[model samples]
Target: MVEIRTERLLLRPASMDDVPAFHNILSDAAAMQFWSTPPHQDEAETRDWVAAMMAISPGGGEDFVIEQDGRVIGKLGLFQFPEIGFILHRDAWGRGYAREALTPVLDRAFSVHGLACVEADVDPRNAASLRLLHGAGFEETGRASRTWNIGGVWSDSVYLTLRNGQRDVG
Candidate 1:
């Protein structure tokens, strides 16, 4: 596992110690609105999720916890190679942490991991996430409706990708 550092953040492998803070993010309704699943009802759910993240084989995937000043604020990584996912505490929103954390992860994904490209599936209504992906040089590949039925509510998806050595197309 690799530990990455940025000007203001640390991207490290997840651990059982992260369960409490991760549960806080996973349990927040506002933060989970665009997530694949609904807000978790308890820490047990987050524990299971974190355990799964920890169990990812080094060659199979990458999962990193995002920390700021030593506090867990979010996470950004590829639990499955070529497909990246991330989340931040609501309190950490609009702070540029996600954007800052993205560059290095994508770099490693292409360089160290030898991936040809990285992809993202954003909920069509999640404007902020769309902007972040777009700004990070990801271009839209396609769109699909009724892609996810989270908690019985249908959500559409916008697919985007950034290839290795690719420059911003916008």
Candidate 2:
């Protein structure tokens, strides 16, 4: 009923069982510097977060946690609009994990979800995410100002899109 296996990752729907590790990642301020919220401080809250992610129906929004060797190192998936969001633990940086992890995420988004295109919005300052998105075959469309509200303050994000099957920009 769950689990979307990639070449090097074993992605699956987040569950209550993944709370501890999920919290560890969610609570890392440095890792989530540009996130919409501060670090999570409660153990029980992690489940609610996972539950919320699970609540994202494939018909609209969907999500999956990126795992390898039985541990979660990052997260990626579609959230309605065929838009994909990805977050990696800072420690997992510079190792090509993002590229490997995204193969299946993109595969599912386009192949399984039947979407014509997928989008990714990254903080312009987030070079790693930008590089990752580009390597995953996304093209920079433009910049969107005041696109995200992170802890009560509006911030800008770089919008990127990946076309699937058949789509026309014109």
The estimated TM-scores of all candidates read 0.97, 0.87
Candidate 1 displacement at residue 32 in angstroms: 0.5
| Alpha-carbon runs more than 4 Å astray in model 1 | 168-170
- Give the Å shift of residue 87 in candidate 2: 1.3
Per-candidate Cα lDDT values, in order, are 0.92, 0.77
**Collision count of model 2:** 1
Tens digits of per-residue lDDT, candidate 2, 20-101, equal 8888888888888877666677867777887788788658877788788888887887756577877777787788777776
RMSD of 2: 3.5
Best by TM-score: 1
Please give the lDDT score for candidate 1.
0.92
Please give the TM-score that candidate 2 achieves against the real structure: 0.87
Provide the clashing-pair count of each candidate structure: 0, 1
